[model samples]
Target: MLIGDVARRSGVSARMLRHYESLGLVRPTGRTEAGYRAYSSEDIRRIFHVESLRSLGLSLREVGRALDDPGFRPSELVADLIRQTRERIAGEMELLTRLRRIGAAGPADWEDVLQTVALLQGLGAESAGRRQRAALSSGEESPVPVEALVEAVLNETDPNVAGALRWALERSGEGGLTLLAEGLGSPTAEVRKRAVQAITEIPSGEATTLLRNALTNPDLVVRRYAALALGARGVADAVPTLIDMIVEGANDVDAADALSALAADPASADEIATGLVGRLAHGTVEPSARRRLTQALADIPGTTASRALADLSHDEDRAVALTATYIRKLRDAR
Candidate 1:
């Protein structure tokens, strides 16, 4: 077969075949009497082999070595190809994500597009300060897409930067609650905590609903954060978890404060005192936990709390009795 026939049969362009010949990747073994390049059957087979290897991302030089060097080992080269292919795929995926984020931002013009790009780059910057600045400015004039802010908030490790990201996410509105809700289900405890924390900063009713749903999250930390946020918002539903926090001594002081905040409403004071007294009465309640619960009663302002303190003043545990007595005195002095 002549070079033209080989090119027609193999789909390798004649120009590329000549370039391959120049590089010694493939060489036809004979010439026609007319002096046109000619290819033998073995040369056609080699051309097919080169094209096959090139399809696997092999460089022309690598293809030449692979075909010509008897000592060439394919394993190392194949592994290198795999690595390079993976890197290329990763770069493409990252670019796709950036384009999706920019498109989600709904930029009105080229300047808006550039600004969104700069903000995203800043959010992913190596410096925490830059990330914080990016987050703070994200929703100032034109907002970064909510998805980008949520992504940054979920991944941010620095406390200050995380705060800024949460603020940015809050300004993005209820859209962030969905992504942050996904974070709540993360197997990583820190991520779940961050998710709830970011949700707490968003003041929408949807965020509150999400928090109410998170009350049942399997992660204890997530439950506590939800309880704290809900309690501050005067959600009576958080009372049980807040009381549990006191009994378990997990940030019991803050939990106590939250309970007190919930108690500020006249309708909730008795209910809050009742939950506290019920925990104190549990047979397995630790004396230290009992004492903590007694101290927690000082913030509850109703008759139920005053009556519970009077009864606890003579309780079996000296620490509990002493703390209750001091609280009763303070309550009576008022």
Candidate 2:
């Protein structure tokens, strides 16, 4: 059969058939005299198998591996895939639970209405992104509308929803950031946080002053968000300020997040980890600070990080001890 005939019989698109071929997941039996690829009925059967596995959430790579190995047990692979899917579903459920809590705190006002719309749009965009990522990772043809979907979500609006509509737009990406920056001065802290988060999505020298000013806001949530934005923007200059917060600030979670961001840059990670170790050795670091510092060090993953985590794993604090164990497992995995 030709590609189209195989696609028709298998219920997979020609594009998807080509994708599976590219991944070496399926192959044409031969070529016709005029050079068109010829697929056999068995090839179409394989395509059906591929589609079935994809529907079950197995990446094409996993499917290919199974197809390549005659001794591979399909039941065992499915069981493992199911376990991973369950864990991911659980994590998403937890996030949804938190979102529900946040939503319940507000009444059905213009802001709430906009937020509801934005949330729905954001969910759609995230789902689409996940599908694309999975397909790309598996070398499969993904039927995703990357640009169109992004543009649509970024342009959606609801006048009665107040700032809620803007939330979805901002979360879309850089374009959303532009819309978010326009509403930084809204009376609501949630709005302010969303705006700051959006602006910080892509860091530039131009955003430094805006983020710096936000960092000093009296609202702890706003300040925490600003610190996070600084890290996302990859502003190296923010490292010293972040280190100061981890060493002396009250919001441990924000400090930890900043440290994680700083750790993304090797130079910043080294500086912070070295300073943290000195603080720990001198007995000046608080228990909470020490815990975050250890996590930050573990994230950097080098000689300094290894040494710091090893020391913390044996620390008197139970939290530090647990973090150290987690760090060791990460290192061992590598």
Candidate 3:
């Protein structure tokens, strides 16, 4: 077959075939009567082979080495191709995400697009200060996409940056609630915790509803966070979890504070005191837990809390007695 026929049949252009010949990747076996490059069957086969290797991302030089170097090992080269392919895919995916976020922002012009891109880059910057500044300025001018804020908040390790990101999301309205709710189900414990924490900052009823749903989440950390946020919001549903936190001694002080906050309501006060007193009365309650419960009840008003405190003040456990006695005196002083 002549060069044209070889090019037409093999799908390799004539110019490319000539280039390959120059590079010794493939050379026509002979010349036709017109002095046209004529490829033998074996030469055409080598051309297909070169094309096949190039499809796997091999450079021309590497392709030549692969075909001509008998000593070349394919394992290392194949592994390298795999690594490079993964890297390319990751880069492309990241670019696609940025484009989607920018489009979601509904940029009015090139300047808007540029500003959105800069804010996005800032959100992902290595320096925490830059990221924090980006988060703080997200709502100004061209607003950073809510999805980007949610992504940043979920992945952010810096406390300052995370807070700013959450604030940005709150200003973005409930747009990020769905994404944050999805984060609540992430397999990563840290992600679930971040999701609940971010949700806590949004004062929307929808956000409150999401936190209510999160109350039943399998993660204890998520449940505790939701309970704390809910308690602060005067949601009575968090009372049980708050009591449990006090019993487990996990963030027991904060849990007591949350319970105290919930107890501000007249109807909630008796229920809160009852829950704590019940825990104190449990036979399985540890001495430390009993003391924490007694301390927790001291903040609760009404006859129920006062009665529980009076009973605990004379209890057999000396530390519990001392703590409850001290709390009763404070209550009397009030």
Candidate 4:
């Protein structure tokens, strides 16, 4: 068969066959009587072999070594090809993600597109300061897709940058809530904590609903964050968790303040006071927890809290009694 026939049959072009010959990858050892290049059956088979190797991402040089070298081990070369292919795929995937985020931004023009690109780059920058600036300016300058902000927020390790990303996400409105919700379910504890913290700052009804749902999260950290946010929002659902925080001595001070905030309402105040009193009365309540509980009741009004404090003022434990007595004095002064 002539080179043309081989090219037609094997899909390697005639010019490429000659290039392969020049590179010693494939050469026709047979010639037609009229001095045209003639490819024997073996040369044609070699051409197919070269094309097959090239399909596996081998360079022409590698292909020559693979086909001609007796010492060439296919395992190493195949492994190298696999690594190169994976790297190429990773690069393509990164580009695809960037394009998707940019498209989601809905840039109105080329300038908007450029700005969005810049902001996205900044979000991924190695410098924390640059990332923070990008996050701070994301919603104000060019609209970054909420998903990008959420991704940055979830992955951010720097506290300042994370705060800025959370701010940016909050300013982006409830658009990132679904992504944040997904983050809440992450197996990573830090990610779940970050997700809830970000949701805590979004002052939307949907955000509140998410927090309410997060109250049941199995992660204690997530539950605490949700409860604190709910407490600030005056949601009574956080009452149980806040009381638990006090009893467990985790963020007890903030929990007490939250309880006090909830206590501003007469009905919530009564309920909160009752919960505190109940915890204190439990048989398993430790001396320290009892004292903390007694201290928590100082700001709560109504006869229930005052009566609890009055009773606790004379309790058996000295620290509890002293704390209750001091709180009772403060309450009486108020």
Please report, in order, the local distance difference test score of every candidate based on alpha carbons: 0.90, 0.63, 0.93, 0.92
Supply candidate 4's per-residue lDDT for 269: 94
Per-candidate TM equals: 0.95, 0.39, 0.93, 0.96
- Candidate 2, residue 214: lDDT: 72
Model 4: how far is 21 from its true place, Å? 0.7
- RMSD values for the candidates in order, in angstroms, are 1.5, 23.4, 1.9, 1.4
Number of the predicted model whose lDDT against the real structure is largest: 3
Candidate no. 3 TM-score = 0.93
lDDT string, candidate 4, 1-334, tens digits: 8888988998888899999999988779988889999988899888888889888888899999999899999999989888988999999999999999999988889999899999999999999999999999975567888989999999999999999899889888999999999999999999999999999999999999999999999999999999999999999999999999999999999999999999999999999999999999999999889989999998998999999988987899999989988988887787
The global Cα lDDT (0 to 1) of model 1 is 0.90
Model 4 bad stretches (over 4 Å): none
Clashing pairs in 4: none
Q: List the residue pairs that clash in candidate 1.
A: none
* CA error at residue 109 for candidate 4, angstroms: 2.0
